[model samples]
Target: MSQVTDQLAQFVVFILDQERFALPVEQARGIERWRTPTRIPGTAAAIMGIINQRGVLLTAVDMRVILGMKPITPTRRSRFLLVHEQIDCAIAVDQVLDMLQLDLSLAEPTPHRGTVASRGLLPTPFGFATWLDLAALLGSINNG
Candidate 1:
C-alpha cells in the first residue's frame, strides 16, 4: 500500500480507457496539450516515440499500451502528463479529470500480481484510482 499518513496527499487524477488513475503530485511535472511526437523506428510498442516539450526531449509512453488497455486516437482532449524523474518522460492520457487530495490510509493494498504501475488502489468519490509508482514504471520500461 502507499504510505499512509495523517495528512492528505495530492494526486493528478486522469482517465484512461474509462478508468481512473492517479499519479503523486510530486512525480507529476506538468500537463501539456497533446503534441504530435516524432516517431522512431524499431522502438517498443508502448513507446510512442520522442517528443520535444519546449526543447527538452522526452520519451512519449502510451499509458494505454503500458497498462494493457485499448489504444485511443489523439484528439483535442488528449494531453501529455509529464513525469519528473532521473530522466523525464511523458505519458499520453485520454483525459485529465482533476487534482485530488486523498487519504492514503484509505488505500487498499493490492497483490503483487497487480499491474506494474500500481502503488496501491485509492477510493475517490468518483471511483477507485490505481495510484502509480512512476519511478518503478518508467524504470521497468527502460530496463525491459
Candidate 2:
C-alpha cells in the first residue's frame, strides 16, 4: 500500500475570522466553551489571561491577536481548545469546526513568509487550514 494511504492522523479544526486552522488531535486535551479568564498583568500580548479548568490552571491565548487580526466579540460558538506542548494552555477561536482524519503526507510546509505559528498548511475540500505548531506558538508566547 502507498505510504500516504498507510499513514493517517486526526486534527481538531477551528475557525478564526473566516479562516480555518487545525492542530493535531493528540496535542489537544479538550475543547470547551468560552470562559472569562483572569487577566495576568505581565503576560504576552497574545496571552488572553488564565483560566482554571477542573483543578488545573491554563493560560489562554487569543489566536486572533497572535495572527494580527482584529478581535471580535465572543459569540455562542466561541470555544477554547486546551492544548499541551511544552506547556499546557488554551487558545481562543471563533468556533470549533470539526475533527478531521487526513493523510499525514498531505501537509505542506508553510512558506517562510507564512504565519510564525503555522508549521504547515493542509488543503481540505472546504478550504485550506493552517496547521498550528504548538511548540513554536508557546515559544513565541514565552519570548514575547
Candidate 3:
C-alpha cells in the first residue's frame, strides 16, 4: 500500500445540523468568518455563489443543502472552510468543532444506499461523524 493508505489522517470536524462531519485536513486551506457570497445565475442550489478571496474567486458551497438538511441562516459560529482538491472552494458550515487525527482502520465504510459523497463514518464519543469525499463533492458541483 502507499504511504497515504498506510497512515492515519487528520480531519477537520464541523457541525452541519445536529450531526458532525469532517473533511481531510490536507485539503483544507483555511477557515474564515462567514461572508456573503455574490450570487451567480444558473448554478446549483448547493452553490452559494462565489466570493472574492484575496483577489481570487472562490465558490462557496452550502453544506446543509448538499447534505439534505434544511437551510439555516448563518449564525455567529458559522464559518467558511476553504478547501482545495482539484478545485478551490469554500464550504459553509454551521460551526467548526475540532480537528482530530483518525486512524483509517477505525473508520467504517459508509452505507452504499446513502449519499455518494460520504467516504466513511468515523465513530466518536458523541456519535458517528461522516467523512466527506471532497473530490466527489466537488465533481458533483462541477458537473451540475
Candidate 4:
C-alpha cells in the first residue's frame, strides 16, 4: 500500500518477444498503437523509419533489433512508445503490459548487469524488468 506522502516513480512496462523491459514514464510522451512506418534509406539497422502521427513525423525504431532480437512483422498487439519529441521518435514494442508506480524512497539500487542499453533491473510485483537507458539506446539514431 502507498501513503499519500510517498513519492511515486512511474515506468512504462513493455514486452519485446518474451522478455520484459521498462523505461521511465518521463522519457516517453505517450504510447500509440503500432503503425507501419515508411522505410528510409541510409539509416541505422534498427530504425524502421518515419511515421506520421497526428500530423507529426516520428522516427520509428524497432526495439527488437536494437536489443538484438529477431524482427517480426507488426501485429495487432504491437505498440509504440513515443519519445524525444524534438527529434520525433517512436519506439516499437511487442506489447505494453502496465504503467508501474513504485515508491521512489523505497527504490533499490539496480545492479550493474552491464549492457549499454540498460540501466539495470527494476523490481516489479511480477518480477524484474530490464530498465532501459533510453539515451544510450536511442543515441545511435542521431549519431548514426
Report the number of the highest-TM-score candidate: 1
What is the C-alpha lDDT profile of model 1 across 1-144, one tens digit per residue? Answer: 233357578888999888888998888889999988899989777789889988989999987876667776798889999988787899999999998889888899865423474878998878998887777777666555
Q: Could you tell me which residue pairs clash in candidate 4?
A: none
Q: Candidate 2: give its CA RMSD in angstroms.
A: 3.4
Worst 10 residues of 4 by lDDT: 107-116
- TM-score of every candidate relative to the true structure: 0.88, 0.87, 0.87, 0.82
With a 3 Å backbone cut-off (N, CA, C), the pairs that clash in candidate 1 are: none
Query: Which candidate should be chosen as best, given lDDT against the real structure?
Result: 1
Residue pairs of candidate 3 with colliding backbone atoms: none
lDDT of 4 at 14: 86
Ranking by lDDT: 1, 3, 2, 4
> Candidate 3 residues 2-116, lDDT tens each?
1244657788889988789888888998898898999998888889988889999999998787666787479999999999898788999999888777777889887642344
Q: Write the per-residue lDDT of candidate 4 for residues 73-143, one digit (tens) a residue.
A: 78898988897634658999988889888555554556543334476677777577887878776765555
Q: lDDT per model, in order?
A: 0.83, 0.79, 0.81, 0.76
- Candidate 2, residues 13-87: lDDT per residue as tens digits? 889998888888878888988988899887778888889899899888887876777774689999999888977
Ranking by TM-score: 1, 3, 2, 4
Candidate 1's error at 104, in angstroms?
A: 0.6
Clashing pairs in 2: none
